[model samples]
Target: MERRIISAGFVQDALAALTRRGLDPAPALAAAGIASGNERVSNLQYGRMWLAITAMIEDEFFGLAARPMRPGSFNLLCQAVLHARTLEHALRRALSFLRVVLDDPAGELLQKDGLAEIVLTDRDRPRLAFAYRAYWLILMGVMCWLVGRRIPLMRVDFACAAPENRSDYHQFFGAPVHFDQPRSRLVFAAHYLSLTPIRSEKALQGFLRAAPANILIRYRHDQGLSARLRARLRATPPEDWPTLDRLAADLRLSPATLRRRLRAEGQSLSAIRDEIRQAQARIMLAEGRLKVAEIAARLGYAEPSAFHRAFLKWTGTSPAAYRTDKQG
Candidate 1:
């Protein structure tokens, strides 16, 4: 099994921090022999770029004479987090902004059943070796400090067996963090979503717009089939829309096999087709040049009425109403 690496977003975040501390990041990048003109700097797919930046920070910025800067680095991140309006908003911002401080490909924060669950997807990796757990701990601690009250954890679930540092985990989270579960997650009450952010949206936007190109490419991977299907829909004409069997064949699987695989992934051929149709319909409606009948024929509908019905199902309104709303 291959080891997935940190994302370029993570590297850019670290560089941003170093810059905040009045340090020139160009020297660090130069030390890593990463050329200024390298497109990878702008591309998000270069996960190793983050690893290189981490090495530089540990070696040059902190140095052997001092302890690792993990604690201090985390402190700065937590300071940013406390500025958010609500804990829910803060978590979303943290997910977007704090990629540099840690990298865990198998982790995600989700809301379900009126609670927030920080889900960890990886089970085979060493628990202590995971960077995101440390980040989460610091975040929880800082959030408590900012709110002037402790947030009780509803439950904790871990994928691995008990670690040697079990006492540390218990003390830090102040919850019964369990182990040997199918998946790891931190469950918390949902009401924390209403807190106002301490930081300005303009400041956050600046960071987002200035995000390194490499980071964008890395994050794009998570957009999943929606992106790929969209690209295909855009590039192909309606007349050339591939049949399910043809698409399955192109993907190197039998039609039945493809349906089974999609089922496992919690998707379906009909859903994908409907999604493509709805997207194309919106684009056509927005363009305003195509007649409704022409659009229906172009979309492979047998009749304009059939197309109207599908459009109504897709948007809860008639196609004419949708176009009128867009014009309005």
Candidate 2:
């Protein structure tokens, strides 16, 4: 399989954060084989690249402090958060506007009662393979810095069992860390919402709009495996219809292992394959050139009748009717 790249906007934010801390991020980036220059990075591509860079910087340079907050991005995000009308509104704005600052997969910020929470879901399975725990720490640290307060955290939650670093949680979050929970979360006092924003709306919007595409893509891609799998199917179609075994092999796992892993991730091979087929069939039908037989063959169906049945199941209409609907 081809290696995924990281978002340029995310890279820029990380670089900016590193620079603010008086550390040269170029070496870490170069160690990950990324360019230190300001070239645009596509959000649709570069997921692995960004993850690799993030891992490198966190392990080598930032360690526990490796979050967007260390750079000015978190402060900028806080400015937007401070400008909102209420704690709820502030968190909502932060969720909507802060995507450019961090390449986090779990991106929910919610407030209730007297507590505020930031929820992050790790999509990757085998629990600890991904560096989400480190990223979570970075997010909390940055948020604390942005509010300019050592805001006390109520608790921390994770889907996985406790790692060896359980002791460090208190130092970083200033709260207790809970493991074996349904999801990862950072709980805090609700009072942080009333603080005034230090940055102007115009400035915030400018930063969000001009954020590097690379980072945006990372956010989108990291959200789930279904999306990532669909993107892969589109980019590199096999010569024949790829079977579950084949696809799993390509992703570097046994068929049984893949099924188990996908199950853990709340997905199934059949669902993903059908999704890809339907998506491709729609695109082909829209082009209005290929005969039903050719489209069927391209999609790895051995017979046009089988393809037609599948199409009807997918769209609730036959292939011809679907095409007519699109053309009309």
Candidate 3:
């Protein structure tokens, strides 16, 4: 997968810790070969800057919390949870270690009603979004690497008001984000907690070597979850798409369980099928080769007229007009 580029504002937030300590971030920025005013930076560049800042302050957390998270503290956390059999056990171990090391913003892992929540308890001082993000990235990043898949977030709530670059939350988490929420928490399907961790000790070493950079950007693979689900839909023609129950049974899950999991990830079976058809229609139209009627039949439409209506609904233009516009 292509690396995700982060906005300059994210860097500014990370540098806030230096500013808090009355320390200049110039040297750290220089170490990372980044400018103070650059509009964006690659994941690697941001990770470099993060390391430089941590070394300078002797705190992995940038001194945002009541106590400084000493260097190698995160490494120990990774080691502590390395042998955990499932995501649930790993998270339990991880949060326990964090509470002992960091004084403020206690973290809790709660699961109920088929959903799991990682809630951060607020203390004396108001928490910055950076602190919230750091805690999340640590847990989330580790969890993804542990399960060998990106656990899609349902929603992320922050206690602090929206920051200047709050949109980055959507780009990073790929979910609806709300600011100034009652408490800061990350939510996802509880079933994911039962997934067995698949990474090895050597893999953990390599992962920590890259640290938050690799964690910041997910390296895509045939890992698990919806990627496999989407791939299954994409492989079969629209007319041959299996029923929900069949698909669920094929994946060894109950139909209701499958539906609930997809819903938690903010997706639906019908919606995914529509997206696939839409994408195929656009590509075929752009090619300017296939007849409109032929394309409609291949997409499982009973008549060209029905396809026309659906096309208009999807793109606000007739298929012929869409083709003509693309051709021109």
Candidate 4:
């Protein structure tokens, strides 16, 4: 599967946060392998820029909040919420944590009529849309990873003016983004709050090691070459996953063009295939109805031992142990 490349406007907006502070973004952008400002960027490059920016500014929130969010702020927040029994517990803790750290934009979790909303109340000036976007990314990113699935957003409302890349923001959030609204808020189903978090401690540790880069990947839209390939692969069984040539033909592109596009998106067919298999295996393990060997066979592993090692490589734990942990 190909990772979607973001618009040039996003690159500019992200870096603008630094430039507005009178800090040069050149060093960070260069460190992330970005050049001309108008060029589109891969998620990897953009994520790298985020790390460099945070490290340089010593603020994960781009110094938008009155109190600078120190380097380890997000890490501590994740660790604090890791043990929560359900999504609602985790979110409330997250909101509370933000309240203690940031002076403006108090966060509240409210539910009524089977819907949940995360509202950010700005005490004085409304925050930049990009800043609000980052906050949502952090919360929704964690929410999706914990639930082991994407929690669909109903709509995102922003009090700030829409930027030139409004459509890009819409795609990034995978939901409609309304600008110049009454307040900044995120809406979703209240029932999602009751679902238990599916990530294990070990898995979260591995996730934190990658940090914002991997976290950002969890929440982008199904766009571009990777999106098309992902749709095709998910529609077929593991055993029926097509070869590159076959997939290229199906996509109506020459094999060479397919290869080039995948490269640009920082993706490979084999890696995408592996990702699909890993996802299917994880879902099966979570359901707890299938035997390990049966699940292995369904995922195209002829031998259960091969499946065990593969699962270990993907999740940092053996299949049986992972299943046991999830059950407990």
Cα RMSD for candidates in order: 18.8, 19.3, 13.3, 11.9
Per-residue lDDT, model 4, residue 177, is: 81
Mark the regions of model 4 whose C-alpha exceeds 4 Å error after superposition.
1-4, 223-328
Q: Candidate 2: global Cα-lDDT?
A: 0.54
TM-score of 4: 0.67
> Residue 171 of model 3: what lDDT?
56
- What is the per-residue lDDT of model 3 for residues 1-328, given as tens digits with 9 covering 90 to 100? 4343777778888888788779988998898778773558777888898999999999998787778899999899989988998999999999999898987788999875445799998776558888898888877877777777667666789888877746776556654578889899988656668889887899999989988687776522222355567788889888788899999999899999998876644456876666568768877988988999999998989999999997876666788988888788
TM-scores of the models, in the order given: 0.39, 0.35, 0.68, 0.67
Candidate 3 at residue 53, lDDT? 91
- TM-score ranking from best candidate downward: 3, 4, 1, 2
lDDT of each: 0.54, 0.54, 0.79, 0.79
Put down candidate 1 lDDT per residue, 1-328, tens digits, no spaces. Answer: 3222333333454465356557677766665445542223433322233334545565212221123444345435554675676777677666544444444324467874345787755434645312434345445544544443344465777776765533544543435677777777877655455544443546445434433332222222123343455457557877688888887787788988877865533346665566567667877987889999999988878899999988875556777777877888
Off by over 4 Å in 2: 1-90, 97-104, 124-130, 198-328
With candidate 1 superimposed using the best TM-score fit, by how many Å does residue 11's alpha carbon deviate from the native? Answer: 3.6
Which consecutive 10 residues in model 1 have the weakest lDDT in total? 59-68
**lDDT tens digits, residue span 162-218, model 2:** 656334333334346677788777775454556543335565555344333322322
